[model samples]
Target: MVCIRCKMVLKDELTKLGLHYTVVELGEVEVVENISVQQHDQLKAGLLKWGLELMDDKKSVLIQKIKNVIVELVHYSEEPLTINFSEFLSSKLNHDYTYLSNLFSEVQGITIEKFIITHKIERVKELLVYNELNLTQIAALLHYSSVAHLSTQFKKTTGLTPSHFKQLKEKRRSMLDDV
Candidate 1:
């Protein structure tokens, strides 16, 4: 689950199954009862109908958590990331940075840094399309050192400079899920 609608659907499905949930945050749910195997299977099947999966594997869950944290930081939050990303991830997920990086790369076939850059670029595309903040403001918002740095990364990722991208009629910006 990556969005609010996803969470709402999951909550509805859980209620239909008579399971009481205390929380239904992105990528994780805390149910109040000890669900039976049949209930678990029912919940999984229900979620599948909504194009969601019930994750049981620890590593997969951890990977999802990593993705969730990045999504929250890039798309949802306004606060700047004060700490180094490695330290932030390590502290948040309670795992060594090396272990998390290795596991993320092994499981997702992309390094964590690459994943972050991809999302950041996507967010840049979003902000540019919005036209509310100029390139300088966007650079500061995304923690880039300067508009030049953002422009370089943007061009490298999308084959179009940020100004050119905004000027285009189509203004192609991918959805967060697509990223």
Candidate 2:
């Protein structure tokens, strides 16, 4: 799960299946009772119907957790991170940065840094479309070193300058999940 609606769907499905859940945070859930095989199958089917999957493996779960952390940080959190991203991610997931980086690259076919850049650019596009924050403010909010850095990245990623992208009639932006 990556969004609130996904959590709601999971909660609804669990209730319908007569399961009690203690927690349903993004990418993780904790049920009160041990689920029977039938309940597990029903829950999996229900989630699948809504385009979600039940990840039973450790590696897949960890990957989802990493994604959830990035999504929450980029799209939801307003506070800036105190430490460097590698340190922060390593501490948050309680694994060495090298391990996480390797596993993420091996499984996702992209480096973690690339994943972060993609999401940051997506967020920048979102801010530009909103038209509330100027380029400098957007850069600051997204932790860019300067507006020039943000512009360079935005141009490199989208093949259009931020101002040009903003002025376009279509105002194209990708979904968070797609990013």
Candidate 3:
């Protein structure tokens, strides 16, 4: 789960399955009762119907947690981080940065830094399409060193300058899950 709607769908499915959940945050859920095998299968099938998967493995759950943290930080949080992203991610996930990076790379076939860059660029594109924040403000909000850096990254990732991309008739932006 990566968005509110996903959470809603999960909650609805749990309710329909007669399960009581204490919490249903992004990428995690805590049920009040121990799930039976039948309930588990039903829940999995329900989630799959909505294009969601119930991850049972430790590695897949960890990867989803990493993604949820990044998605929350990039798309939802308004406050800036006091520490750098690597340290922050390590601390948040309670694992060494090297281990997290290696596992993420080995499983996802991309480095964690690359994942962050891709998400950041996608956020920048969303902000540009909104047309509310200027380039400088967008850069500051996204924690870029400067507008020049943001512009360079935007252009490099999309093969189009921010201004050019914004001025086009079709404003192309990717879905957060797809990013």
Best by lDDT: 2
Model 1, range 63-120, lDDT digits (tens) per residue? 9999999999888887887899999999999999999999999999999998988999
Model 2 worst lDDT run, 10 consecutive residues:
169-178
Tens-digit lDDT string for candidate 3 (1-179): 98889999999999998999999998999999999999999999999999999999999999999998998999988799999988999999899989988899999999888888899999998988888999999999998989999999889899999999887724334444356
Which regions of candidate 1 fall more than 4 Å away from where they truly are? 170-179
Please give the RMSD of candidate 3 to the true structure. Answer: 5.0
Rank the candidate models, highest lDDT first. 2, 1, 3
Off by over 4 Å in 2: 170-179
* Candidate 3: Cα lDDT at 41: 98
Q: What's each prediction's TM-score?
A: 0.92, 0.92, 0.92
**Please, what's the RMSD in Å of model 2?**
4.9
- Give the per-residue lDDT digits (tens) of candidate 2, residues 1-179: 88889999999999999999999999999999999999999999999999999999999999999998998999998899989989999999999999999999999999998898999999998998888999999999998999999999999999999999887724344444356
TM-score, prediction 3? 0.92
lDDT of 2: 0.92
